[model samples]
Target chain A: MAKNTSLYEKHLAAGGKMVDFAGWEMPIHYGSQLEEHHQVRRDAGIFDVSHMTIIDLSGREVRGFLQKLLANDVNRLKKKGKALYSCMLNEKAGVIDDLIIYYMHDDWYRMIVNAATRNKDLTWIEKQAQNFEINIDERPDLAMLAVQGPNAREKAHKALGNKILAAQDLTPFFAVDCGEIFVGRTGYTGEDGYEIVLPSQQVPQLWDDLLTAGIEPIGLGARDTLRLEAGMNLYGQDMDESTNPLESGLAWTIAWQPEDRDFIGRGVLQKLRDSGPNNKLVGLVLQERGVLRNHQKVIVDGVGEGEITSGSFSPTLKCAIALARVPAQTEDQCHVEIRGEKRSAKVVKPSFVRFGQSCID
Target chain B: MSNVPDNLKYTKTHEWIRQESDGTLTIGVTDHAQGLLGDMVFVEVPDVDANFNSGDDCAVVESVKAASDVYCPVSGEITETNEALADTPEMVNNDPFGDGWLFKLRPTDPNEISTLLDANGYQEIIAEDSH
Candidate 1:
């Protein structure tokens, strides 16, 4: 049997189609997934993200440990509540997981990782911490909700009540501790929103309150479509332990400056940088009526073949879009094999939609 | 919460059949089928004039979450297919019983549909599946 989140009963009450995801019983959709996707784009929507893993690190050597463990530089987060997105890589430069790290205090940092990667990530982090004196506290008692859209901030403010003022001045990628809840101005969808991390026991009340506040309850189906429209990569689908950040459209997250910082995969990354990565991840927009899907072969006419990592019917764009890993020499026009027939697609930057607007022409 | 018309015949695989006076029959996925599949993104109907026996996979309905095959409930030759679904597949979810009819077929044996289940029988299947 799959484990249930704190809001599982509430989701069932609201007509969510329950499905098993990452060993957890989660909602795939409440009713119409297309409507839910439009809800987030046009107005406010809430997502139950309690399945994501949260770990807190507190120690004198926390910053040093992070600098060596993550591909991104944590030193850039000088101000409190600042957050940085980084990828944890193995010694071979293969990506273990991509996560957001928030600097809470001089000795404390909070990181939220993907749900499916929790056990492996914890094991890897614990093994690495043996050399440094740090405490890794996995906060299973926390339940998360992401309220996102064009008017999400204002609606979240209204729903949160007393914590409104403290969260008002928060900018993107910043977080604030509002007594019992931690509100971060971050989201997976390409929309403005707040991700609230609070005690698990209090989650059902918050979910009901958000629903009463006129926020629609979105599920994992729309969440996937929304994130894919934003060109965000899903951990296991887009890249995994066998894939590296350089080839996964996450090269920008790797900070290679200050030459001697020496992050975990710095050596292999530097070598790849010097020799150049053979494959690059790009966006694909189907010019025809077919829906693009994962594992489809991407045939760049003159160049070599590639494969689609994540693909979906973009509700916002009214068409299909995909993220594909193609040869470095691949250009604008390519053909994707759908069911046996080769269909033409246009290659562009990885983003298709952001802030409810189409990014590609 | 799905509508099951009393006059139609149903299949264990979730398809519905409506016999026509012109010796042809219309077929579509039931309301319960569309409800379970969520929003329909694409529907791949079998080509007109294709022949199939009962239980043969004849069409596909794809939602955002998954793709499911629609099997033929009775042996027939496909006379027509709903082409409008190529652009607006949501019709299946919006009006599954009427405008969302997937295909039409001329029956090889008009009596073959008697072996299929009635609405009450289909409801029983759905109710059991729900549990």
Candidate 2:
């Protein structure tokens, strides 16, 4: 049986159509997914993301341990409540998982990882921590809600009540400890919002509060489209333990500077970087009527064939968009094999929509 | 909470059928089917005059997350296709029963309709599947 989040009943009450996702009974959509996508772009929307694993690492050697464990450098997070998005890679330089770590104190840090990758990620992190003295504390007692949109911040402020002042001045990519709830000004959707982590008992109340504050609950269906539009890669679909970050449109997330910092998979990644990646992750925009879908074959004439990692119709852009891994030489245009028929698509930067605006031409 | 009209018949795969006055039949997906698929970004309506056997994949319903095949509920020749859906696919989601009718067909054998499901039977199937 799939596990239920604290707000499962609330989801049912809101007419959510529940489905199993990553061993959790989650809502795929409450009603119309396109409308939910629009809601997050134009107004406020909330999501029950409590299935994500939260690990709190605290020890004197946490910083050093994180530096060696993550592909991205944690040294950049100088201020308190600052967050860093990094990928944990294997010895072969393949991504184990991508996660966000918040620096709360010198000896304490909070990490949030994907729900589907929780078990593997915990095993990997624990295995790596054997050489150092640090605590890997997974917080299952917490529930998370992502409140997102252009109007999300103000609505979240209204719902949070006493914690308003603490979160009011928070900058993007920053977080603040608001006594009972930890508010991070970050989200998967290409919108301004807060991902609040609080006690499981507080979740239902907060969900109702957000609803009362005029924020509607969005589901996983819209979440996937929103993230795909933002050019964010999903684990398992985009890349897995077999694909490296260089070929996965995540080279920017890799901290290659300060050559002395020998993080996990550094040597292999550096070699791959020197030789250059043969396949590249690029964006595809279908100008016509068809919707782009995952696993579709991307044919670039004279160049090697590629596969779509994540693809969907952009509710904001009103067209089909996808992230595909194709040959480095592939440019300008490509043909996607849909139902055995080759359809033309324009190749551009992976990001198609951000902040309710079209990032594509 | 999905609507199932009592006047029309349904198939196990969630397609709805309305017997027209001309003896031809209008076929579209049910509200339950549309609800399951989410928003209809595109609908690949079967070509007019196309003939199909029962259980054949006649048309496709593409949503944001997935593409599902709309099977031939009853063997028929496609008499007409919904042209409006080409420009406004959301008709499948907005008004699935009326304007969203995918095609009109003249059945090979009219008695084949009795073998399919009624609205109550279809609701039972949906309710069972939800569990």
Candidate 3:
């Protein structure tokens, strides 16, 4: 049997197509996926992402523990409610999971990790925290809802009421706490949004309230397209324990400052940085009429071969785009194999679209 | 939902076949298949004039999430293919029973058609599989 979220009944009531995802029954879509995708881009849409695991770390040694545990330094969080995106790596510098860590106080911090890697991440955190006076608690009583798009913040404010809405001024990548609710100005979609984490019991009402506020209930289908458009990497698809963040287009998430600080994978990362990786993750935009997809072969003239990690049709751009791991020396133009035919593509930096604007050149 | 026309036969795999008066059979993926697939991004239909056996993998449909194989229900020689699907694959999602018909076949053994499930039987299969 699959585990059900607090919003399972609500999702079924909304005519969702439920499927087993990471042991949880999740809505893949509510009717037309394309419509849901467009809804998040043009208006407002909400997703029940409670299946993601949230872990709270608390203790006097929390900051020191995090500085050594995460690739990104949490000390950079000067203000409360600031969030940092980082990759938890193994001893070999392979990415175990990409997560968002929220700084709440000197003694308390919150981390949200992928549902599929919950057990492994928990074990890894526990093993690392054994020497430090840190307490790690998984908060299963919390349910998360991501309300995204141009009208997302407004709809969330309307649903959450005025008291909680006062935190609406939070800058991007920041979070605010209002009693039991944690509101974050963050989302996978390249649009304005708020991801609210609240008690499980209050989830259904909040979902209903958001819907009443004219926010369409979206599902995982649109979530994938939205994140792809944002050039965000999906765990297990774009990178895993076998890949390092340096070659997965996540180098920016790594905080290399404070040279004395030693994170779990620092040594291996330093070596890799010194030696340079053979392949680098790059963005590819198809110049022809074809959809780029994962595992497709990429050919670069006078360079080595590579494979696409994530690919899809960009509804905003009305063209096919992808993230591929190509040879480090690969240049501007490359060919992606689509259905046994070579399709021309342009290699560019990622963050294809952001906040209603095109970021690709 | 459109009614399954009485003249066509359906397979458990969600493909429908229509036998024309000229003894040729037109086949297509059902609307239910397209809906489940979400959105159509790429399609790979077998070449015309190719021979296929029943249950053979004859076409490939790639949606945004994953790829699926469309099997041939009846053994036959492919006489014509739906060229329009090359450019407008969403036709399969919109009108699977009509313009989205994948290919036409001249059955090597016309008796194979008798073993296929009718609309009622196909509906029962879909309901059973839903569980």
CA displacement after TM-score superposition, residue B42 of candidate 2 (Å): 1.0
> Mind giving the per-residue lDDT tens digits that candidate 2 earns over A164-217?
569988999999888889999999998999999999998998899999999999
Interface RMSD of each: 1.2, 1.1, 1.9
Q: Show pairs that collide, candidate 1.
A: none
lDDT score of residue A119 within candidate 1: 96
Candidate 2 stretches with Cα past 4 Å from truth are B108-115, B118-124
What pairs collide in candidate 3?
Answer: none
Tens-place lDDT digits, model 3, residues A114-173: 999999999999999999998999999999999999998887787778747657689999
TM-score of chain B of each: 0.98, 0.98, 0.94
lDDT of each: 0.92, 0.92, 0.89
> After superposition, which runs of candidate 3 have C-alpha atoms over 4 Å from their true positions?
B1-3, B45-58, B72-80, B106-116, B120-128
lDDT of 2 by residue, B41-130 (tens): 888988898999989989988988789999988899999999889878899999999999999989999999899898899999999988
Ten-residue region with minimum lDDT total, candidate 3 chain B: B1-10
Where does model 1 sit among the CAPRI classes? medium
Clash count for each candidate, listed in order shown: 0, 0, 0
Please provide, for model 1 over B1-131, each residue's C-alpha lDDT reduced to its tens digit, 9 standing for 90 to 100: 88999999999899999988998999999999999888889899999999999999999998887778999989989999999999889999988989999999998998887899999999999999999
